[model samples]
Target chain A: MPIEQDYSKTENGTQPVESDNQDSNKTPTLPSFTANKSSQTVNTLWRTLITPNSPNVTPNSSYYELISFYVYHGLLVLLYFNIFIFGLITFSINRTKLWFFELAYNPSKSPSVISADISKLNKIPKRISVILNLKPEETENGGISGLISDSSEVCAWVVASGIKYLSIYEYGGELKNNIPELRRSVYKKLAVYYGTDNVPTFSIKVPHANAIYYGASDQDIDQQRYKNTSYKPILQIVLLSNVDGRATIVDLTKVMADLTTTNEISPKDITVKFIDDELKQLVGEEPDLLILFQPYLNLQSYPPWHIRLCEIYWEPDNDAVTYPVYLRALQKFSTCKVNVGK
Target chain B: MPDWMSTFPGYQQILENCTSLFASVVRTGPVPQHIGFIMDGNRRYARINQIEVKEGHNAGFESLARLLQVCYKCGVKSATIFAFSIENYKRNSFEVDWLMELAKMRFGQMIEKGDLCEKYGIKIRTLGDKSLLPRDVVECLEEAERTTANNSKAVLNVCFSYTSRHEITTTIVNILENVKKGLIEPGDITEDMITNNLYTGDQPPLDLLIRSSGVRRISDFLLWQCHQEHCDIEIIDTLWPEFGTMQMCLLLLKWSFNRTYGRKKYRGKKETKKEKEKST
Candidate 1:
């Protein structure tokens, strides 16, 4: 029952005092007259019970009123029961999903203890992207080689987990010269895990299911445009500065301005469709999951247009990237309800 | 009628007492000056309840009313809600029409003299491209804005037919036009100049952003503002209609805690750096 109309106004306000005894004392005590008055009172009571908000109607004054009370209260109880049941079902489902996730990816356990069985997990995201913040402090601990080894380990785990696409972005460093070495190491690690024949083959002639590197230069982007071969289970290593330089909204603004001038169209006529097409040609499809290997939730100059609807998972400790942590991020992404503002 | 009822005055009194107690507890924390909401999950709520989409939107409106009242009591000054978006037009015509009708009705209520606007002294402003909306709906929204023009207690910014990308693009176009007209030099186009051209330029930077429906994404709503301010984002699992006062209070408490202790370390460093620069 709605709370607004649950109670009668008379219940909150003062009720008028009844003068039944005084009226009876002043009138003659005739049995026939008293019988008729009693019948009239019963009729009026029945009328009030049948019609809501009737003038001179006092609720809960008779047996009919008691029945109505039970009806209303019973409906209210049932409504509450429905709400309680719905809440319980939702809670148990969420609890079960979380329990399953924790069972598979136990954070308390060491990285070796958590096995990488992609089939056993509840869900695996098709595309997984990780942003590694190679700040001075991070590289100072074990040098650039340590960062590269950590990224390679992450890639090996991603391949082992059967993710179709993996992307690794390194921020705060000039890594253009080291791309070949990093790619070779990642390929070697994958070969060790999946054997030589099972490892993804790399070829500069074509965009194959292999490790590819993109640098922070327009030439790299132009080179990518020519190699349009579709490859599954490909690993893309991108420098964060490269994506930022190429895929920033500022670039979109430039494109919009040029289009407005060249095409002789109003700027207001430009929509996301035009911008999206340009972005798709620049940056590939948005990743299903974005994992930030940072101590805090910072984008680290990530391109904004690409991640509008991307699910972001952050590792707060900036700890070594582990297979279990990667799996857990994928699981979290799968459970998320992408409402899309519908 | 009942023995316990005899001891207590009424349920309303008990409710008021409890509300005041909750308010006092919330008063201990720092309230945000501006908060943004991505109101999501209405259609899902309707699907779960097996009700019509229109009824789901109505329930969402009820929740919005309750949330606004709670925010007012909690001392929140300004709130921007993602009520409608440009992408929403892609939905089926029936749903789009229903939503427009709902907006019209709600705005009509706001335009009426003695509604929540009068009671809470809320200044309502529709922030978006109005040309795309129905004429009657736009009229109602304008009338509501005109009616509550002088309100100073609180501000409600309804992002109807709005998208952050479009807003940014529009602002950029405005800047380019100004430069072309020689009203402003191209070199003088600073961050502040672009910001002042935004629909929410006069409003305070967002302190917190809350998205309901378990989705962990910004959905192109206030992307630039949130990214610029580094606003704390909280994604709640509950649908928009089910996001009640208690949930809002919990989110506010979390925001207050983060503001007081979490981000202060980095903020302090930045402030000191600015101070040293000024001294030099």
Candidate 2:
């Protein structure tokens, strides 16, 4: 007597394998047919004529099923094509909108355009420092006036955009003597942009959103001197070279050596904190964003200790300082996630 | 004979001419005091080429030998290569063993040919944890270092089983020990002191850092020296085995341009006045 076969396994294996093989073979055929037929009517005819055999399918029902399958698949293809086209159209529209916005509001493109969106300015960094490369002959060939105009425009934008604090540093020692004239130029430009009534006054003592100029001799190396007053939201103009003329590190080293010789203090106790205390006396506070108006990332000896964590922004090929480029740099800085060596 | 000249007999004269030309061209710009290399993608290069892993490592070594010669010609005082990292020890045992064997063989070859180091005056110093390495490998490294101890024309730093964090931690521990011993007081520590105590204390701070295989991360190499300094980093898409002197020269040219034109305006007034007088 013949033993009963395991029909369940046979059915499960053979049915799926056969169906899968058929599906694998038929899928490519459909696409090839559609590609060769070219016209919609021929595709319908081809689908109807090439109805593959199914065990349970009758001629009449299979014909209707095949028609429905073609109809549904054609609808899906149309839907996907429409979606892709719509996506492209929307992307182009959004890009054009952004381009138009940039063209109209970019101060670099048209220096006279002072109008900028306050919402966009809300994202500006709270503390922004600009390091300008100032040459000795900056006064010649309209460079000084051009700088004054750029400074005024930048200051006006800062005020209008509601930025809290702005610091302008002349990287070389040449511009140190002309801080007063530069400050006056900036004040005049702000007045012209915001009208005399709204323009913030230039003050040396009061804690308000005002322009304060610091020449090399004026920068007192006493941290206690700035402790009492509130460092209010203000524009600070610093006419100092990138080089630390005071040689703070060298002096600190000397101080440490002297302390080690006399008091017998351990040298390892002179940590970054002790150095930071001296640095605080040198540069008041570390800037959140440092913008370099140069072609490359040569810090020009910006106080090394202070800029350890500062985010630096500089364009490689483009050296022309424009208000729009400055704004873009600020925008880029706002999006940066600073990893402070943690 | 130089290492490359022995390796490639037909191209000896061409290589010498190219070396001389590069030497002349490099003198026009400021040479980087120290250059660091993050060698990456040897295994990937092997995988792509369908070659034995050992062959890939040998190719990388060949490229490194050529690069060292170019760096010496360019007047680069010190060159550091991340030969094997602490993290690299986690790779498969087969690959790790192959790398270890390859390193031993290369160091042994260098030791055998004493004239190569003598000709170039290259002081080879391995920077890493010595205890983690095998006995023979460490012996080879020690031998190479001992033989090249006096050569000072150029320095080669092979970071084997090294990590920047480990280096920093080790330096700190040494400093603490000195403080405990009263050999150095805690209050005397400065940036320069810390630099002098580091593994690269005798060498200048890294001026240019080049990473191969298109990876942008520093991969924990030279953290202390590169962090606060103006060290320029160049990431190239080529694999370590494919990197050559031409790629290094291109990077050097860019860095030299940045140094010359980028910071020239910020020079002190005295220097500018002297230039003006010379022009007049």
Candidate 3:
């Protein structure tokens, strides 16, 4: 089978359908509506046939189960409502944490403060990836501009923490479309910290589009005090969205299958190491830590091939992209030991 | 505590009746057709209880048996458990040997006792590279499957020496081999094709993936299947040995509840904004 067929049958199988057919045959009163092609009549007829006006109640296991389920579901609904209330209360508090975190480490605060906070961690991931959600444009920190500013702020935090590689994944691929605006926003934000004279260089890459944009113009680099060598940026940022996650893998799989048919590659050659290396080349290498800014943890279809051993971090009831979350994720990655299945 | 509770008259029978009733009630609303579990923290549970590691794993097995009984009772179509990972072999040789021995002994017990598979009509399928397993373990696994070969009610996928990466790779390899054989064209290699050919091929789509020990990472168990929008990956803080059937039933109910009401914490997970709006 080339597809996952529905092998699942409920405890009640085709017996329900067979019984319904028998009911239609026996009931001469239902034939007029059954003969009618209108779905509206069929629905009412089906409903009447299924729900008898008088149910012969029996105080058996099935009867007791109904009462227990009522109580269970009633309690669950109440518990859910309670959780929603708590979520609302914590949502306001977490929103305040965003402001407090920014106030403690904003553009006005020198870059040294951020580095000091980062320096406390035992180890920080050289490569860190984050999943950012794009909220409705009506809400604050929610539209395209809000997304751009959030991206820049995270970029600033990543650079200040001295992390070299950063990947930002927006579920809808919104940031990929506004790269120029993102580059300008990040450059401005970083310049505020390091000052216009010596802003660190960074590059933004969209792996799906195979596009790269570097920060700092050639003339701006020419004015630097020390002649920068190696010609590499201090930070490398990769922009990924939903399409870049699994769609790319499917395309690669098709190509590989085609190549095999043409005798270009052997079937045995497509081993685990082969897939890993291919993914490393197609999609980027797996990041050591992934931070989700959502209130709860859901991958939202991040590239499955790359998340083999990477640690994922997310805050409960925290939705905004904040500096505190990023710093805390790094701190967690530092203290955590990735045994890599030892 | 467990021994004392079991010492009471009709304790086990009462517990079973309660679990079956709970499962039946949950089955009334919605039941996940396919479920996956990452049984973690066995070694940690062993150390915490000051027991031998072997006994911890044994307890974990007991918990699995109990949970799967509830799952099948709830009419869950297929239950996949991460019995062992390919990476598990990287552990010391002694542990690996013991784990194989434990599997062999437990599988022997399962078939002999006419346990869950026999009672619930569950087809036992060992999904992984059989070549890597010791000969005795492989034979025992085959025996279990052979005994349960004709079961049509449900399926139990025991991922003994498995990893998601390995499963995907093996699936791809098998696909390519078929293409080379001219059985199908390369164009047939769709995402569904790969998904259906994995160790979990032919089973229903995975609905719920539960990992114990609060380890957020999936540890490479069904990585491909769980990335889908519908799969709910629930991480519980309980150790594998201590995990209970009632906790699992409640988790299933929570998943159904969230799916029905579209809980915000669980939103943007299964449905995108536009799709949710369209559905409303």
Q: Which candidate model has the greater TM-score, 1 or 3?
A: 3
Query: For every model shown, what is its TM-score relative to the native structure?
Result: 0.66, 0.52, 0.84
* Each prediction's fraction of true contacts recovered: 0.16, 0.03, 0.46
Distance from true location, Cα of B170 in model 1, Å: 2.3
lDDT of 3: 0.79
- The digit string of per-residue lDDT tens for model 2 on A159-262 reads 66566566565544444445566656666776676576655533221111123433112343423434446744245544345444224444455555555556
Better of 1 and 2 by DockQ: 1
The TM-score-based order of candidates, best leading, equals 3, 1, 2
Worst 10 residues of 1 chain A by lDDT: A202-211
Clashing pairs in 2: A266-B185, A266-B186, A266-B187, A267-B185, A267-B186, A267-B187, A267-B188, A267-B189, A268-B186, A269-B186
Query: What shift in Å separates residue A270 of candidate 2 from its native position after superposition?
Result: 2.3
Please count the clashing residue pairs in each candidate, in the order shown: 0, 10, 0
> Each candidate's chain B TM-score?
0.88, 0.88, 0.91
Best by lDDT: 3
* Residue pairs with clashing backbones, model 3: none
lDDT of 3 by residue, B1-280 (tens): 3668778999889988877656645555567899999999899999999999889999999999989988888779999999988999899888889999989988887776567778889888998988998888898999999998999999999999999989888888888788889997877667778888888879999999999988778788888898766787888999999998768877877776667576464334334666887989
Candidate 3 lDDT, A1-342, residue by residue in tens = 001112213313655786689776776666554565578566556545543222221221232333544565555566557646765788799778777776775534467878988888888887889888777765777778988898888888888888889999887887898877888888898888889888888888888888777774435553353244557788899998878766877778789878987889999778798888888877798999999998766788888887888888987667788777777787778877766566
| Interface CA RMSD, all predictions | 11.7, 19.9, 5.5
